[model samples]
Target: MLTALSIRDVVLIEALDLDFNDGLGVLTGETGAGKSILLDALGLALGSRADSGLVRHGTDRARVTASFAPLKAGHAALDLLDEAGIEVEPGEPLVIRREVKRDGGSRGFIADQPASAALLRDVGATLVEIHGQHDERGLLNPRGHRALLDAFGQIDLSSVAQSHGEWRAAETALAEARERLLNDVSEREWLDHSIAEIAALAPEAGEEEALAAARSDMQKGARLVDEMDGVDKLLAGSDGALAQLRAATRRLDRLAAEHPLFAEALAAFDRALIEAGEGEDSLSKAAEALRFDPAELDRIETRLFDLRALARKHRVEADGLAALLEDLTARRAAIDAGEQSLADLESRVARSQSAYRNAAEALHAARVKAAAALDKAVASELAPLKLDAAQFRTAVEPLDQSQWGPHGADRVEFLIATNPGAPFAGLMKIASGGELSRFLLALKVSLAEVGGAGTIIFDEIDRGVGGAVASAIGERLSRLSDSRQLLVVTHSPQVAARGTQHYMIAKTSDGTVARTGVRSLDAGERQEEIARMLSGADITDEARAQAARLMEVV
Candidate 1:
C-alpha cells in the first residue's frame, strides 16, 4: 500500500505531502483542479519518464517521492530492490524518489541509494499497477491471462516447466555429442591411418635435443682433429723443446749442489720440465678424442634432420609428437564408438520430447478447464457493468509441439464480442477506450485475488458510462480493495462515496503563482465535495441529499 507521497516544485505543486491508506481512496475535483497532476507526480516517483517542463518556473529541479509499506517481508518489490543492490531494512517503508532538473536530466533513487530509471521502473512494477487511458492493461495481455488461469486453478506448473527445461537441455547436449561422433564415423578410415602413422613414429622426449648435439659435434670434428694433431707434434717431437729443456735442467742440478745462486735456477728448470710434460699428455688425449667414424656422424645428422622435418610437416614442435599421437588415438576411438553414441542420443532425445509433450498436454488441459470458468465469471461481471450483450471468451489454439516455449504449446488470447451476432475479435482491436476500461474493470473484479500484490490505481475508470454503471464500477473497486489497496480518481459521486478515505484536488493561486493542492476531506467536507461532483460547480440541497444517500449505501 502507498503510505505517503511528497512533491516539491513539480509544475503547479510547489511543496506538498499526502498520506494514503488502503481501500478505495477517491480523488475528486472539477476540471483543471490538478487531479491529473497529482497522479502524474505519483507516476514520476514510480519511474515514469521525467520532463523538465514539470519543474516550477523559479525552481531548478522537481522531485517526487513515494513510500510504500509491504504487506509481507518477502514481497517481490523487496526482492527486486535486493537484486538492484539497494538495501531495505526489515519493517521499514520502501521509499522511491525521482528528480528532474531544468536541463531535462533526471535521477532516480531507491531506499536512498542511487538508481537508474530502468531499475526504478522494474521495482515500481512489482509494487504498484497503474491503469489509465493508455497505461498497462493486464487483461489484454495473453501472458497475464495464462498466469491468471494458473493462479485461479491453484496449480504450480513452474516445477513441471523447470523439469521440462532441464530435460531439453540434456537432450540438446546429447544430440551435439552424437552429431560429432557421426561425423567422426564418416572419416573412420582416415582416422585409423593417421593414428597408425603417429604411433609408428613413437617419438621420445629429449631424443631430438640429444641427436642435435651429436650432429653438431660431428660437423666440427674434422677441424678439431687437425688442430689437435698440430699441437701433439709440437709438444712431443724429438727436436721439440722438451728434449732440450731436459739437458738444461740436468746441468742446472749439478751447479745447485755447489752454490746457492745455482739452486734457484735448478728449481725453476725442474718446474718448466714438468709443465711441458703435462701439456704433451693433454694434447695426446685431445687427438684421441677428436677421432670419429664418418659414417656414424653422417647417420646421426640424417636422423636429426628426419625428426625436425617430421615435426614441421605435422605442424607440431618435436616435443609435442607424443601429445599429437594421443589426440589421434582418441579420434580413432570416437569413430569406433560412433554408432553406439548416436543411438544413445536418439533414445534420450525421444524420451525428452515425450516428457515435454506430456507436461504440455497436462498444462493445456488445465488451461482449458480454467478458461471456461474464467469466461463465465467475467461474463457475469459484465452484466452489472451494463454489458449484458457482451461475450467474453478465451481462445486457446494449439501450437506446434516443436515450437513449445516456457509458457506452453498453445496461444491463448482473450476474445470478446460487444454485441449479438458479431464475430469475436481481440478485445484491444474491437473495444472502444471506454468499453476497454469497463471490460478491464470486469476482468479485474473477476480475477481480484489471483494477481500479485501491490497498489492498484484506476485513473478515471468511470470514463464513458454513468449512473448505475458508474456505481457498479465503484462497487467493484471497493471489492478489489478488500485484497489490495486501490486508488481512484473519479467524477462520480457514487465512486467518491465508496472511498474509505476521500481527497479533493483543487487549484489555488497566490497573487504571483498558481498551485495545485490535495487535502483529505473530513466527513462534512467529503459530503460537500460529493455534492459538488453531483451538481457540477453548484452544490444544491438536493445534491447533498443525494450524496448523503450514496454515502448511506456505501
Candidate 2:
C-alpha cells in the first residue's frame, strides 16, 4: 500500500508532504482546488511522462516521491524490485522518486538507485492502479486479458510455457542436425582425402621444434668444421705436440737414472708423455663427434615442411594438427551414423510437440471454465449498480496455429451488452458514462482479489450517478479496501462519506503564488467536508444533517 507522498515545486503544489493510510481514503473539495495537480504529482512519482510546465515558477526542478510498504511477501512489485537489483529489508519501504527539470529533462529512482523510466513505470504498475471513466490500461486493456484471466483462475502456466520451450529447442536441434548431415554428405570425398593426408604425415605435438633445433645444430657444425680439423692436426702424430713432447722426454730420462735426483726426474718425464698421449686421444674423440649427417638433415627439413604445409591448408598451427585430426574423425563418425541420429531427433521433436499440445489444451479448458464462473460473478454485481438488463460475458476464442504462444492457444476478452436485445461486444464499444463506470467497477470487484494492484485510486468513479447508485459504488469501493488500499476523488457526498479517512484538497494564495494543499479530516472535520460536498458552496443546516447520515453509511 502507498504510505506517503512528498511533492516539491510541482505546479501549484509547493513543498507538500502527505502521509496515507490503508483502506478507502477520499479527496473532496470545491472545483479547481488542485486535486488534479495532486494526482499529477503522484503520477510523476510513479514514472508518468514529465512536462517542463509542471515545474513551479522560478524553481529549477520539481520532485515527487511515493513510498509503499507491501504487507504481503508475494506482492508482484517485490519481483520488480528484485529485477532492478534493489533490495528492501524486512521493514523497509519501497521509495520511487522522480525529478523533472524546468528544461524538460527527467530522472527516476527506485530505492535511491537510478533506473530507466520504463522500468519505473513497470514497477509502479505492479504497486498501484488508478481507474477512472476513460481508463485504457489494467483491466480495461484487451492485450492483458489473457494474463488477467489466468491470474483470476490461479492457473499454473509454467508447465505449458516450459513444454513449448522444449518443443522449440527440439525443433531447432533437428534442423541443425539435418543441415550438418546435408553439408557433410555433399563433401564426403573431400573429408576422406583430408583425413588421409593428416594420417599419412602422422605429426607429433613437438616434432616441429625438435627438427628445427637439429637443423640449426647441423648447420653450425658445418660452419666450424675447419677449425675443429686444425685442433685435431695439432694433437695428431709425428710433428704434432704429442710426438715432440715424447722425443724431448726420452732424452732427459737416461741422465736422471744415474742419481737419486735423476731417478725422480725420469719419473716426471714418464708422466708428461702419458699426459700428451691422453690429450691426443681426447682430440680424436672430439673430431669424431663433429661428424654431421647431411642426408638426415635433409629428411628432417622435408618433414618440417610437410607439417607446416598441412597446418596452413587447415588454418591451424603445426601443434594443433593432432586435435584437428580428432575433430575431423568425430565428424566422419557422425556422418556414418547421421541417419539414425536424425531419426532419433525427429522422434524427440514429435514427443515434445505432443506434450506442448496437451498442455495448451489443458490451459484452454481451464480458461473456459474460469470464464464462465467470472461472467456469473460479474453479472451478480451489475444489477445492484442499476444495470439489471445488461449482459456481461468473458469470451474465450481459439487462436490460429501461427498465433499460438507460450501462454496457450486462446485469446480472452471481456464482452458486454448494456441493453436487452443488444449483441455482446467489447466493454468499451457499447458502454459509456455512468454505465461504463459501473461496468468497470463491477469487473474490478470480480477480479479484485486476483488482478488488482496494492493501492488503487479511482478518479471520480462515482461521477455520473447519485443517491442509491452512488451508495452502491461506495459500498463496493469500501469492500475493495478491505483487501487493498483505495482512494477515490469524488463530488458525491455519499462516496466521500464511505471513506475510512477523508482528505480535502484546497487551493490558497499568499498574495503572490497560488498553492494547493491537502489536509486529512477528523470525524467532525470530515462531516463538514461532506456537508460542503452535499450543499456545494453554501453550508446549510439541512446539508449537515444529511452529511452526518451519509457518514454513518458504513
Candidate 3:
C-alpha cells in the first residue's frame, strides 16, 4: 500500500506532502483545481515517463517520491525488485524517488540507491495499478489476459511449463539425431575407406621408432662391412701384416745367440705376431656379426614411410594413427546402426509430445471453467453500476497447435456487449470512454477477491454518470477498497462521500505566480467540498444538507 507521497517543484505543485492510508481515499476538487496535478505527480513518482515541462516555472528540476509499506514476501513488486538485482531489507519500506531536470535528464532511486528508470518502472507497475480510460495495462491489453485469469483462479502452470520444456528438449534431441544420421550417412563411404586403409597398415605404437633405430644401425653396419673388406685383404695372405710379423720373429730368433739385445728383440717380435693373430681373429668375428640382409633395411624404410605418410594424411603423428583408426572404426559402426538410433529418438519425442498434449488439455479445460465463473461474477456487478443491459464475457478461445506453449493452447480476453442483442467485442473497441470505465469497475469488483495491485487508482471513473448511478459506483469503490487501497479522483459528491480519507485540491495565485496545493479535509471540510461539488461554484444550505446525507448513506 502507498503510505506517503512528496513532491517538489513539479508544475504548480511546489513542496507538497501528503500521507495516504488503506481503504477508499478520494481527491475532489473543481476543474483545473490541480487534481490532475496530484495524479501526475504520483505518476512521476511511480516511474512514468519524465518530461522537462513538468518542472515548475523558474525551477531547474522537479522531484517526486512515493513511499509504500512493506509488501508480502512473494508479492509481484518484491519479485520485480529481486529480478532487478535490488535487495530490500526485511521489514523495510519501499521508497521510490524520481527526479527530472529541466534538460530532460532523469534519475530514479529505490531505497536511496541509484537505479535504472526501467527497473523503477517495472517495480512500480507491480505495486500500483492505475485504471482509467487511457490505461493500457491490466484489463486493457489482451496479451496479459491469460496471466490475469490465472491469477484470478489461482491456477498453477508450473507443471505445464515443465512438460513444455521436456517436449522441446525431446524435439531438439530428435533433430540432432536426424542431422547426425544425415551427415554420417553422407560420410559413410569415406569412413569405411579410411578405416580400411588404416587397418591394412596395422601400425603399432612403437613400430616407427624401432624401425628407425634398426635402419640407422643397418646403414652404419653397411659402412663398416665395406671397411672390413680392407681388413680381410690386409690379414688374409702370407704377405699380410700377421704373416710379416711371423717372418720378423724367425729372423730375430736366428740372431738371438749373437747378442742379448737380439734375444730380447726376438721375444718382442714373437709377442707382436701372437697379438696380431688375436686381433685378426677378433676382426673376423666382428665382420661376421655385421653381415645382415640388405633387404631388411629396405623393408624397415618402406614400413616407416608408409606409417608416416598415413599419419600426415590423417593430420596426426605416426604414433597417434592407431587411435585415429579406432575412432573412425567406431563412427563407421554407428553409421551402420543409424536407422535404429533414429527410431529410438523418434519414440522419445512422441512420448514427450503425448505428455505435453495431456497437460495442455487439462489446462485448457480448467481455463474454460474459470472463464465461465468469472463471466457469471462480473454479470452480477454490471446491473448495480447501471450496466444492466450489458453482457460480460471471458472468451476462452482455442489456439492452433503451433501456438501451444507453457500457458496452454488458449487465448483469453475480456469482451462485452453494451446492449441487449448487441455483438460482444473487445472492451477497448466496443465501449465508449464512460462505458469502459464502468466495465473495468465491474470486472475489478468481480476479481477483487482474487487479484490486482495493493493500491488501485481510478481517474474520473464517475465521469458521465450522476445521481443513483454515481452512488452505485461509489458503493462499489467502497466495497472494492475493503480488500485493498483505492483512491479516486472525482467530481462526484456521492463518490467523494464514500472515502474514509478525503483531500481537497485547490489552486491559488500570488499576483504573478499561481500554485497548486492539497490538504487533508476534516469532516466539516469534506462536507463543504462535497457541497461545492453538488452546487458548483456555490455552496448552498440544501447542498450541504444533501452532502451530509450522502456521507451518511455510504
Candidate 4:
C-alpha cells in the first residue's frame, strides 16, 4: 500500500508532502487546481516518462518519491529487491524515488540504490494499478486475457500447462532425432563405398621408409659390383704381380743366412707378399656381396609407389590411411542402422502428439467451464453500477490445431454490449470512458481476492453517473478498501464522502507564482469539501446537509 508521497518543484507543485492510510482516500479540487499534476507526480514516482518541462521555472530539478508498505512478506517486488541485493528494513516502508533535471536528465532509485526507470515501473506494477482516462489498462491486453480468465475463475491451471510443455519438449526431441536419421539414410550408399575402398588399401605404418631403404641398397649394389670385378682382375689374374713378388721374396730369404742386413730386407719383402695375398682374398669376398639383381630394386620401387598413390587418392598422409579407414567403416555401420532408428523416433513423435492433444483438450474444457462462471460473476456486478443495460461476457474461441500454444488451444476475449439493442463487441470498442471505468470497477470487485496488488488508484472513476449509481460505486470502493488500500480522485460528492480519509488539493498563489498543496481533511473539513463538490463554488445549506447525510450513509 502507498504510505506517503513527496513532491518537490514539479510543475505547480512546488513542495508538498502527503501521508495516506489503508482505506478509500479521495483528492478533491476545482478545475485547474493541479489534481492532475499530483497524479502526474505519482506517475513519475511510479516510473512514468519524465520531462524537463515538469520542472518549475526557477528550479534546476523536480523530484517525486513514493513510499509503500508491502501487505505481505513474499511479494514479487520484494523478490526483485532480493535478487538485486537491495536490503529493505523489516516492517519499514519501501521508498522509490525519481528525479528529473531541467536539462532532461532523469534518475530513479529504489531503497537508495541507483536504478533505472524501467526497474521502478516493474516494481511499481506489483504495488499499484492506476486506472485513469488515458491509462493503459494491462488487464485489457489480449496477452493477459487468458490469465485473467483463469484468475477470475479461480482455477489452478499450472499443472495442465506444465504437462503441455513437457509434451511439446518430447515431441521436439523426437522430431530432431528423426531428422538426423533421415540425413544419415541419404548418405548410406556413399559411406559404404568409401569404407570398402579404404579397407582394400590396408596401408601399414613405417612400410614406406623400409621399402625406400631396400630400393637404395639394391641401386647401390649394381654400381659396386662392376667396381668390385675390376679390383678382383687386378689383384688375382694370371699376369698378377703378387706371384713375382713371392719368387723375389724366396730368393732374398736364401741369401739371409750369409748377411744379417740381407736377412732384414728379406723379412720385409715376405711381409709385403703376405699383405698382397690378403688383399686379393678380401676383393673376392666383396665382389660376391655386390652381385644383387636389378629386378629386386624395381619391385621395391613399384610397391612403394602403390602405397603412396593410394594415400594421395584418399587425401591422407601415408600414416593416416589406417585411421581414415576406421572412421569410414563406423559411418557405414551407423548408416545401415538409420532406418530402424528413424522408425522408432517416428513412433515416439506420434505418442507425444497424442499426449499433447489430450492435455490441451482437457485444459480447453476447463477454460470453457471457467469462462461461463466468470461471465456470470461479472454480469452480477454490473446492475448496481448503473450498467443494467450492459452485458459482460467471456468469449472463448477454439484456436486452430497448428496455432495451439502452451496455455491451451483457445483464444479468450472480454466482450461487452453497452445497450439493449447493441451487438456484443470487444470491451475496448464498445464501452465509453465512463462505461469502461464502471466495467473495470465491476471486474475488479469480482476478482479482488485473486489478482492482488497492494494499492489500487482510481482517478475520477465516478465521473459520468450520479445519484444511486454513484452510491453503488462508493459502496464497492469502500468494500474493496477493506482488504486493499484504495486512493481515488473524485468529483462525485457520494464517492468523496465514502472516503475514510479525505485530502483537498487547492491552488494557492504567492505574489510571484501559483502553487498546489494537499491537506488531509478532518471530519468537519471533509463535510465542507463534500459540500463544495456537491454545490460547486456556491456551497449551499441544503448541499451541506445532503453531504452530511451521504457521509453518514457511506
TM-score of each: 0.81, 0.82, 0.91, 0.79
Best by lDDT: 3
Candidates' lDDT values, in order? Answer: 0.83, 0.87, 0.89, 0.83
Estimate the overall C-alpha local distance difference test score of candidate 2.
0.87
lDDT value for model 1: 0.83
Summarize candidate 4's per-residue lDDT along 1-554 as a digit string, tens digits. 89999999999888899999998888898878889999899989888998899998899999999998744678889888887777787777799999999999999999899878888888888898888766665555566688888776676666557767777777787777667667767887877776777677676778788888888887888788877767666655556677677777889888999999999999898888778778877776877777776677778888788878878987888777778888777666766786677677677767766777787777778888988888888888899999999998888898887877777778898888998878888766844788888888898887777775778989888888898898889999998888889999988888998999999999999788998989999999999989998888999999899999998887
Model 4 shows how many backbone clashes? 0
Candidate 2 least-lDDT 10 residues: 70-79
Clashing pairs in 2: 256-262
Model 3 global lDDT (CA atoms, 0 to 1): 0.89
- For model 1, which pairs clash? none
Q: Which regions in candidate 3 have their CA more than 4 angstroms from the true location? A: 223-290
How far in Å is the alpha carbon of 274 misplaced in model 3? 6.4
RMSD of 3: 2.8
State, as a TM-score between 0 and 1, how close model 4 is to the true structure: 0.79
Clash count for each candidate, listed in order shown: 0, 1, 0, 0
* RMSD score of candidate 4 (Å): 5.1
Between candidates 2 and 4, the one scoring higher on TM-score is 2
Q: Which ten residues in a row have the lowest lDDT in candidate 1?
A: 136-145
RMSD of each: 5.0, 4.4, 2.8, 5.1
Worst 10-residue stretch by lDDT in candidate 3? 426-435
